[model samples]
Target chain A: MENRVLEEWEIKEMLSRYGIRVPRGIVVESLPEKLELEFPVVLKVSDPRIIHKSDVGGVILNIKNYPDLKEKFMEMKRRFPDSKFLIESMERQGVEVIIGVIKDRTFGEAIMFGLGGIFTELYRDVSFRLIPIDEYDAREMIDEIKARKIFEGFRNIKANKDSVVDLLLKVSRLVTDMGGKIDQLDLNPVIVREDGAVVVDAKMVIIP
Target chain B: MFEHLLNPRSIAVIGASSDERKIGNVIVKNLIYFGYGGRIYPVNPKNEIIYGHKTYPSLDSIEDEIDISIITLPATMVPDAVESCVKKNVKYVIAIAGGFSETGERGAELERMILDKIRGTNTRVIGPNTVGIYVPRSNVSTALTLPERTALPGDGSIAFISQSGALGLLTMDTIAEFGTGISAFINLGNRIDLSENELIKYFEDDEKTRSIVLYIENFKNGRDFFNVAKETVMKKPIVVLKSGRTSEGARAASLHTGALASNDAVTDGALAQAGIIRAYSETELMDYGKVLAYQKPLYGDRIAIVTTAGGLGVITADYLVSTEKGVGMKLAVISDENKKRIRDTIVPFGSAENPIDLTADGSTEQYSRVLEILNSERNVDGIIVYALFQTAKVDETLIDVLEDNMKGKPMVVGILGSKMGKRMILEAEKRGIPAFPSMERTVKAIKVLYMRGRYLKRRYEDGEQGS
Candidate 1:
């Protein structure tokens, strides 16, 4: 089967349909007259070909006004001539974590939950389980990570563990519902606040 | 389900020989020495007497119907031998020779031929390169190792299944030396036919088996193995020691999820999800097995440490509370009323804190009284009693005290390793109280039981939530 990565907006749209929270975003071929979103928005090139958008200057964040949004959108469009632009309201930072699903060759459809960024890259602190998981498995995955102490309130950060569990259960269901169509799905830096979790960035690889 | 393989009424050693060095001789000697009750038929072309019993020239000559056949011939000869076993209608065949699929293409062809002969027949095969099985309960053993070299365990509850023959035998010896008994030991060399999944289901219903331990290098069907294990663990605990844990899967990964997963890390989670305790070493394999087999699941994490030595008490407490190395068990707080009750049992100098030190001069009666008090405390979920037999007042009677106080809650013993300590451990095991030679091992065994408890609780809630 040929695998293809879906555009970020499409992936986020799919996530929201499964009852997962995603940033309110829009994809446009050109800068719009006025945006429906609030101030302080983010503009990025929504091309599946670009994996690390920020690494290649495809992303510009924290645009406080429509003028900056329009300026950054034009600049991003100029940098990537063939790509469409994605504009969204900027989100406040929270505890960063990654939740993903991969159709594993051996175990098949396994869900992964781990701390995002350095904890994932350096410490490799993560836990996994075969998909179609229930509330019990979701709860256990939270406690299985090495830095589980973070969930109970680490210093100034107050991460809601229940929201993470809810996100995990929904992802598990999404993968289960998609079945063989999804090869991999990553919700990197899923901002987890005391109130709830939102998929700040998403990249999904689907079987075409 | 595998009655012919597990509880055969009669067995035939096809490559029966008189030479002491041969595998056939070792198998025959093990069977006779271990006191197998069923008929033993030795088949060889040479019509001679062997092991004080008449040998049949071929399997067909055994008129009573062979329940199983142990084929100890060369790889090239295995297919032909299997053909004859099938002709004789043998229910199961244990081919003990190597050089089958494990060798190369020629061997693979032989394995296929062997498989072809058994297809659509009532017969089943265990291995073309395997040491086969050892069941102490029925006095039946097909292990290729010399019986005198290893300390064979007697009939007990733990059933071990291994993919490697030598490791299985070596661990069996260690488990035996540690005073833990075995219900059965099966080696899945090359896994030509029977797999661990089937044995898991069989042992789940076996009256003699209380816990199942597996050492698998790879899986024939991982999903089926896990699914069967998930169902069986609700009835009995299953522990697995899976090697090759390196993150080989990460190199080929295209995403962070795949990259973060070492095949083993995913396997570890899946095993836990299925309620199987994962063991990292052979010692840990039996350590977890013996405890899970003998004791009930520890339903809570609150642990109380009772020791005669203050230093041992302090270390045990550290191990229980250290989340870095330990399972982060809470040091149970004993109420003031309970402390007063324990204080009256020990000497004036003895401390009645969480460890409840009884001092060096603590007596057997004092240990028993303190344990009785802790066992009754609702806050204390489990108890660890570190007994120093060298103390003047303590003796083998401490084992009886531990056994008696083991009524309402779970408890383990930590004894210093010595000649007397070995005897105490054996005695404690005989009475069904898991006693370890070290404090860490004792505490870690409790962690395994605690994990089992948590899994059971999760599963119970799963059922309560309706699936």
Candidate 2:
């Protein structure tokens, strides 16, 4: 396996190589002729340099078909001309999880995992452990998150426990392997589907 | 400014009067009282002799090298006095005068002038309205006021920085009373030059400072403070007591130091993000400082409470378990089943469940029995014992029991009773056990210990995963 700073596509490619599931998508620098996916697909600016796409109105979602996708793509292109766009099939129902690395000045690299997608910052319900976490440590991180109850099948929703745990361990391993080379890697919405999980969108800040 | 303030070889007190009531006189007396080994220079422009030492007219008249110049003069003449000391090449100047910055516009302007004069020079000023600095390892205290009578120079473990001069002095007095020594005590009054964050970064690598305690009313730069704190706390435990938590307190802090008290919730979140423990009160500040100064980090939340009184033990257990989502731990009140296992050696009446209530009539022997049983239990990660020495029957025995049983356990003790009971509590402290008179203090201490333990366990578990 290559150990270098990976861009958005490069990271997804590496994750796919590691047998981790990622949302099927295509990157386009311009508006596509016609959308290939079904309705309710996600369109996001796919520049690795842009960490928070939603903050800058760089994401458009739930387009029904080709007409809607073309209109949204044109609007996004008008706003961020230099940015590449990614269109992927959306995972409608799944628990959102975030996996990232924070370089703790004293202890060096620390991997953090918790409930994600907007609520992460609002609740700040995250747990941190040193990098290269194992399955047991990943399980402990899941338990420490404030939304742990939700992950335990709360509110008539059965959580995909095995997939979520596997995703956390894989993210931890990826961060440890990258070491100081990657400043931060955020998989904001790792959807925990009923039978499996998928990394829908992710970003990484590489050290210059 | 004199070089002796930071690296003092020889020091002298100008205007060092014999009178104990004046600031000048107090400086001279405390230096001798703290046992300074260097040459003593007591200069009073008026008196030819003071404190049994020949008084010189000024820094110019002093024949020897003056590394430090501590000026305690009237506000108007301070600038001129500083200039005289500058000519003498005094590298460190600790201006203990209070009129500047604290006495309104004119004083603030005077302070600016002082700063302007000191600029572009090797001389650094500690405070214009300050309480001096203390280096315990060298028996040096440049502050005008002395700490509490009980305080002695000890092996330094914690470095303290305070924005308030009076609070800094008060904290030193408190530390002295508690028999804890500090590596350094810095009072950043008005913060005309140095800042709390700079001191934090300085102490981050200092071998003498094991833990850092900060009493801050405001931050010069909140983001910078957060980043430095995040880095520092992971290496050394950082406990902070932000004084202006309430609106009223914020107003008071603003008037005191011109600090804009940020919203309490935001500050709390930011502090937590940096892993800095926010202490609610002065009592918690000292209590946590003491705990973090000594105890090892806890590994888990599971606690085994051993108390002579059932009520106190139950209260402690309830607190440990009762959060928003029911009880966090499965509290086992030392039951008869576990008691039976140790009954051959211990008394039959002792409860064997988690809160091992040895009964009110419990002696040190009973404490030994309960501790031994709890320590042997796999579920117990730490222990909190409430030892009440109400009568002579269990007083001596309790001390012996605690001394023997509390060898390696992460334990905290709460003692409840009158003045004599408080004395017994101090004796327990003397035997390497931190005993508090109030149950709340005991609980808070245990919680801090538990927090540290959790930090350690998290690191250990994560380290294993990383490996």
Candidate 3:
């Protein structure tokens, strides 16, 4: 029954350990140590205290070059004096699906799958299954969503449905492996690319 | 756990009275009027006889192996009555008083007093503030409602258990109107013992029950309840109507599970895991119960709609496809060969596709013949027939056609008209077709049938039930 939020880097580390794809990233309090090679990178204010970084303009995406990235990083540092920033290279376009695990008191941990991004709030199309579900159950969760048609390359938008299914199975296995140490996990907007699914924005509330 | 409580052969009404206004009087009178063949003992210290039957001044006066005793005394007198019933070696007891834990701390302490008295004895109590059990099979009727307002249901396979007393009676009353019999009904108010888990397990082997319906507000131990539900569903369907889903009730949750996940959503997951069909209203509860009890569970999603009205066929089709707000069911695509059979049977003007309309001039023969074809079709798993009686072509004889036909492949019949429609639907339901007058409701009934069908198929798929 963990109830405390974990840092974004810690969440990514756990996801990577479970073979869930995530952007290669690092955390830093200052701009000096090392620079990323990707041209268009994403810089996120990764303070555990800042649950909603976008709300505070802590997220500066598409920092096209090194100079602009440095200025934007310096500006974010000035606003949040003691905050740690996370930097990762931006990925390509893909479909967004949210995978969540909440430790329900009555039914224990239940896995949730639904359309992610802004459309998630508008449609609220989600389905739930209790944890320790098999790969077949994971596929059912993907098929349960009515908007699943989009996964079949709707309007020339390529998305490998099998990739999403694999992501669900891996996340389920990850949550089950953590047992009671993890209270709730939210991988909102887990982008489904042609080859595999990537955890775009991850948050975990650990059992305290 | 609940056999002795649900099917007690003999019962005694403590605080029995001859007066009409008293509940003691009502219990005794209902016992006799409801045709409970079991021996009835009226324990009244002030009277020697009640309604021409022998009455005793105390439990010690006269008794011959009491199986159940009803305590109708005040809250303060409950402990003494329970002690006396225990002394008489009663196996089950029903406390019909209200001033218990639901009242205040003092009342709670008094209710605890009764619980303390029954500790070492074999006597199990249903409630300190409840309506008790009603089983037509054993001739046990303890619902607070009088016979005049609603008669006890005949013997049937559907059993209902609820936590609300008055609501249980009202639910039973509503179910009785549908012509379905009651195998057992329990109003588990202020559950001291005999929770839903134990009762569900009790029905798992009971030969009389084919389906179980529950009206639950909360679970004493949710994990235990789900465990029992998982086992029970492999045998029969469980229909649940969960009340108090509003955020007001949800806000009082103390645990993180209650706070993080909505009660409604968590309950939905539980229901899905247990293969329970959740009912949105009282109507759907009985509606689903009727279908589950009468028709064979559906084996697939394909359904064919046969109706006299094209608009009704369209309405049912829209409802079937509107899965977001409703259960998504596929309309059966009739093959060209079968389509030709339908086309040849109906009038030339009538459409003979999936809907299989026989026009307003359609005869009862067309309706009957099309059902035979659909029944023999391998693609068709279930059907929804919109038999609107307003059309001159359809008549009461159509009921006979539907009744004799519809050979165990799931079917839902809907009729929308005045008295004729009402009479036809009721009559059709009496024959076990799960008929309704509204197209939306008919579609819902079809959904439940299909749900049960799919469940049964999966349940028996491997030919080996692990449990």
**In lDDT terms, which candidate is top?**
1
DockQ each:
0.68, 0.05, 0.29
Each model's lDDT: 0.88, 0.70, 0.80
Output the TM-score of candidate 1: 0.96
Instruction: Give TM-score values for chain A, per-prediction.
Output: 0.96, 0.89, 0.95
| lDDT for each residue of candidate 3 in B291-394, tens digit (9 for 90 to 100) | 78777787789889998888887777888877776679898999888888999998888887877777787778888888888888888888888777776767
Report the lDDT tens digits of candidate 1 across residue range A129-162: 9888988889889899888888987786798999
TM-score sort, best first? 1, 3, 2
Worst 10 residues of 1 chain A by lDDT: A68-77
Per-candidate iRMS values, in order, are 1.1, 13.3, 4.4
Q: Write candidate 1's Cα lDDT for B272-359 as tens digits.
A: 7899999999999999999999888999999999988999989889988998877788999999999999988889999998888999
Report how far off residue B219 is in candidate 2 (Å): 6.1
Sort by lDDT, best first: 1, 3, 2
Cα deviation at A43, candidate 3, in Å, is 3.4
Error of 2 at B338 (Å): 5.7
Better of 1 and 3 by lDDT: 1
